[model samples]
Target: MSHIPYVPASTRYDEIPYRHCGTSGLQLPVIALGLWHNFGDDRPFQTQRDIVRRAFDRGIFHFDLANNYGPPAGSAEENFGRILAKDLAPFRHEIIISTKAGWNMWDGPHGFGGSRKYLLTSLDESLQRLGTDHVDIFYHHRPDPDTPVEESMLALHHAVTSGKALYAGISSYSAEATKEAAAIMRDLGTPLAIHQPSYSMLNRWIEEGTPSLLEAAQEEGMGVIGFSAMAQGMLTDKYLGGIPDDSRLASGKVNKDFFTDEALGHVRALNDIAAERGQSLAQMAVAWVLRDQGASLTTALIGASSTSQIDEAVGAAQNLTFTPAELAAIDEHAVDSGINQWWGVTASR
Candidate 1:
């Protein structure tokens, strides 16, 4: 499958920096591409391919995916694989690819959960779909209470040892579960390299508890990469004007119930602050998440529905810095919009 020979860009936006994943030798860009939306079966292949190339051109080297990210589950990986086989194969080792396997993928028991059977088998299928022999990071998409913690950790350990994954991570787990998983991974000699958690202006639960749990991993040497950093575009001004036709809300992918009047008010206020700072609402929202005072993060996993959005998001890297006063203003104005309520608060398991 010969692609139209996209000559890779020689220079990327220098504003975006790469940080090491915990104590590991791998470094991920501050912003990463996520396939949670827009890379499904319904979208055109060339368009998605263009978006992927644009992301890489801007130094977004990590692309995150999950088994159930598409409307027809597995389609995201299948689509991504097409791009990989065409244009990305030449830069495989230069990029860091990641995928998860903890959500529902099939109809029966083997389809989902943290059991060794599910996780391992899912990885093989994921590898096939992504057109890769191994992923840079393999994550347990979620914790399974029905399956023992040790069992899940062992599966992750196997992924690294078998050379199917360079590092292992867990997502959407409670603070307690994170600590326990980290401990077992440590004892098994795998040493968790990272934890993928949902974090955004509207979701501060991880800031309260999960960070503390990650501290133990940090001590043991594991970095944290936040996912959904924009709260499904709710943090942006896309919904402030009553859901534009081009917005995700208009696509019916995200539920309309999240577009509350209160959320819109907060977005408008944040937009005003962003205007003062000479940044777009989306830029400010992303800059806010990545702007760490002392404990800076390794990367932010974000999604884009179009190539224009991808360019805008990559440009937001320039607005990463904020002053003490600006930070205070954001804290005062931003709402942990409950868009990530399930993972940020009660739903974490």
Candidate 2:
């Protein structure tokens, strides 16, 4: 295909739904785009552009990325930056772009943790790769066990104060850490804007403390947005007939051994219930994560490999409700995937 000029849909906002992220006055789309899987050097640039273009055309204006999101660290950000510069630059203010640090991006002592040096240096490199002056949300990807929590939080504060990020959020932080970090930010006068954790019916570690997390976030006015709602695509129908060649399981992102026989049985039962709900397994799975909006969840982060996947995932925003019986049906099979990276985390409820 030739390099085609992109023209975004004019009625895009009419296609998707948006909700407030915590209490910070930022309304994010019900479904946000994640650049974790694709948008790498391994993928074609035009295909990456098309997926992002399609997502924006459907009203998904929030794009999420982390510094180490590629097979080779930093490729995803480099690719997305190219797309942003070439295509979305004109509409930059209309979108909420978020990126994170605290992962293994480069070799050496200062490259992997939440020190001021690492966080600030990483954001600068990310901005250069993203081809932007600042991001909408800058996150600390995880808590550094060796670094003092105050130091990490301080680095995050600097991002906002220095104008490198409009707001600060944390990912994979426990409820206790969120409380402490929220307080640190509060004292600094830079209240947290959101929390990003991987959540799905299949991995509910975050669910264990959601009510309390939301309560605290509400009291402090912070919002929560969840990622991995599809469990790397296991929640979708593609695995019902055994893994396809192109599936994430085959690609090794989702562990094939994680879905044991027992897990498969639960998946099939859940798929049947999804069918009854008039949704694809993927749609119901995505919607299930957002169905508990009363908990103050701002959005569900979705990742797509193609334009068609983007179209299908957007359907999650359409039917966001469920009955008592439907909720009961889902619980019967919503077992923990055991592959959730944030499992075993506990916080006061």
Candidate 3:
């Protein structure tokens, strides 16, 4: 049998600096690897294994997963669970593992949403799928209008209090909802640890009220991690030319009907700004999201299909410095296409 690629025991773990998530004491790599697309059932197991190994070698200590990330739903977790059983189990203590449950899972009402039953059951299934006793962070995937906010927070609070999760967070919640949830979680004594929201060069909706939300989180010693920091690869050079064959846009998972001529034109303009910054579109995009000068902004949740693509994205950390003039130029040219209206901060606006 071919030997597993030699993962050097002395792999430099200091390549990527660990930043605290929000105000919490838990530290994560500045860039975290997410298994949203590439860890599915259709993908090769070896390829996925390599990606996870490479990430750990490079000091990306955080791995983000969700219950419904795979095409068959729950497949990503199962696949990751296998990796954990074989390779990651030895290093589990050194890693920060996170998972979420907010979107639809099965056909019925019990399969999804942020209800107490769904949250509890989903976590159990996710734990089984991930083959882990406890996750570093468990998040409510999205806001649930049908359930009372207290119910959702209590479920998350229960996860931490019971030792199922070390910390808790809420993903894609409105600034108002985040405040309410944080207050309740604080009251429960578990306290919210982080807030995961979509923030990118193209999407600035979170900025509308995120500052205040962040301020409160800091007061409570929680952290904030931004996802969709690259706007689903829209801010990358991969789309500069007509949608390439290997790009995610070409993948059947992404609906092509939405990317009309207008969206393409907008992408072209944003690419020009990247060129001016002397950075790849993806690099510039990640840097844009990490612009919180003194405040403790934790990490960026980035997804990649291939090892090379992730390498390019992680290269963004090298050029985190941005001048005021560059920031202004980016704001002037980078405009959202209203594609993310469903995002909590922009849903009503």
Candidate 4:
């Protein structure tokens, strides 16, 4: 099938809210599109293209990806590259494209980790696959327990100074690591841009303050972006009644055991609050993340399986404010669902 000529919505910017990135002049939409799952080789290219188009039409300008974000790995960037070439190339300057280096990409020792070799080489590969001169934000995907933080941060500095990436970020780094990494970037004069972590109403780790990682970023003037804001469908309406036969949670990375009766009870309670707010449960979940941004978070990095899901998430900006009573009610049910797909992937290693 031939691709249709894309025309963006005229009211694109009306409902979306943009916030400053810490003290940096750079600003990002309250919600960012994360190509973590759907934009891969396994999915239809046109669907991927449509989702990107709809997201931009809804005022989302940030497209976040990592080097290894696909079933076969690296397919997300390659696929998005085609979409960019065919459709979004003309609007490149209007988008904030970011890709991370770290995580497994190629074989051998140099293919992964936070070392200078892996980070820089992987970024070049990401740029090649992204079909761009430079990404708006480049991140060292995670802390390298094996490599020194200074070494990893220096490569991020090199990425910015070399003009391959305009800004720098980190993901899944703990409070101590965030402070150390931010200091390294500050000393190098790159200055940390943002930090991505697995956060949602279900996980509640950020709220737990194991040490308050976002607090560290705030003091250092770096921004926060929360990923997995829906808890892999737990915080959404899908599991409120009970996991549907076709639910993604029925069989996926998330163990079925985590979706306990108690967890569903929480989801049901939350859904009632969302209904009272005149929004879907997923919208409420995303908005709750943005509500604490700048105060504790910056952007909610959302991943969607369908374009309508993106539309629903964008609609979240319509009603972000929560009453003290609503928040207190939320606190009543936002217990740890005991499932973190992110940690399930990384923590064991």
Question: lDDT per prediction?
Answer: 0.82, 0.86, 0.79, 0.84
Local accuracy of candidate 4 as per-residue lDDT tens digits, 97-170: 99997888888999898889999999998899989999999988877778888888889999999999999998
Instruction: Name the TM-score of candidate 4.
Output: 0.93
List the candidates' TM-scores in order: 0.94, 0.95, 0.92, 0.93
What local lDDT score does residue 38 receive in model 2, on the 0 to 100 scale? 84
Of the candidates shown, which would achieve the greatest lDDT relative to the real structure?
A: 2
Local lDDT at 310 for model 2: 94
lDDT for model 2, on a 0 to 1 scale? 0.86
How far off is model 3, as Cα RMSD?
2.6
Tens digits of per-residue lDDT, candidate 1, 256-337, equal 8777788777778878888999988888877777887455667888898778888888778877889888878878757666
Candidate 3 regions with alpha-carbon error over 4 angstroms: 2-11, 210-216, 293-296, 345-349
* Model 2: CA > 4 A from native: 1-5, 209-211, 343-349
Q: Between 1 and 3, whose TM-score is larger?
A: 1
User: Candidate 2's residue-wise lDDT over 1-349, tens digit each?
Assistant: 7766667999999998898887677999999999998888878888999999999999999999999988678889999888888889889999999999988889899989788899999999999989999999999998777788788889999999999999999888777778888898999989889988888888887656545555656666788788998887878888889889977788787777778888888889999999998999899988888886467478889989899999999987789899999999899899886867663232222
Q: Which regions of candidate 4 deviate over 4 angstroms?
A: 1-4, 292-296, 341-349
The model with the greater lDDT, 2 or 3, is 2
Off by over 4 Å in 1: 1-3, 13-15, 210-217, 341-349
| TM-score of candidate 3 to 2 decimals | 0.92
- In model 1, how large is the Cα lDDT of residue 157? 99
- For every candidate, C-alpha RMSD to the true structure in Å: 2.3, 2.2, 2.6, 2.7
